[model samples]
Target: MKAVVLVRTRIVYAATAFAELVLWQVPKPVVGCTHRFKYRLAYVVDGTCVLRYDNEAGKGDHRHYAGKERAYGFSDPDKLIADFQADIARWNHENRHP
Candidate 1:
């Protein structure tokens, strides 16, 4: 199943623990619901992890962790909400109409 949390017109944040990914998106302004600034954070509970952001394109910004380290950075709910809003604004501007 898929879960989506929409913080605003431009931002959407989603998480799928079973799928091992947390996703964030900022949709294009003119495109409205088409183009997006998409990001995904991927990890395995007992394995390694990879945090990927649009900043580096699809190549991804990678980070590796052993067992327990995988649980370290996934606990901030408030920050996640804030990040959604900020990303929305930035993405909207990038796609804004002329």
Candidate 2:
């Protein structure tokens, strides 16, 4: 079977901020991941990606935020999206103007 794209879209939050999401359902797991889904989610502001979640080859599942990288417990696609959105909210609350 071929890899199928499940989600590929961008969410515009402001003139200088947006979120990009790309998810694919693969025939098998990546080099390090255990699931069949591969995804990359990012939140950018002022031309800088400040938050991201992904499961790249040989890296398994992880997230990058505020110049820090950490392991992420990926449950499902819905939960992954929810967690990413929550992190975006937290980042904006701490860094962006109201």
Superposed Cα deviation of residue 6, candidate 1 (Å): 14
lDDT of 1 by residue, 7-95 (tens): 32321232321113344444431121223433343322223222222223433322332222221223243454355344344443564
**Stretches of candidate 2 above 4 Å error?**
none
Off by over 4 Å in 1: 1-75
Candidate 2 lDDT (Cα, whole model)? Answer: 0.93
RMSD of each: 16.8, 0.9
Residue 49 miss distance in model 2 (angstroms): 0.5
Error of 2 at 1 (Å): 0.9
Error of 1 at 11 (Å): 9.1
How does residue 1 of candidate 2 score in lDDT? 95
Top candidate, metric TM-score:
2
lDDT (C-alpha, whole model) for all candidates: 0.32, 0.93
Clashes by residue pair, model 1: none
RMSD of 1: 16.8
Which lDDT tens digits does candidate 2 get at residues 27-69? 9998888899999999989999999999999999999998999
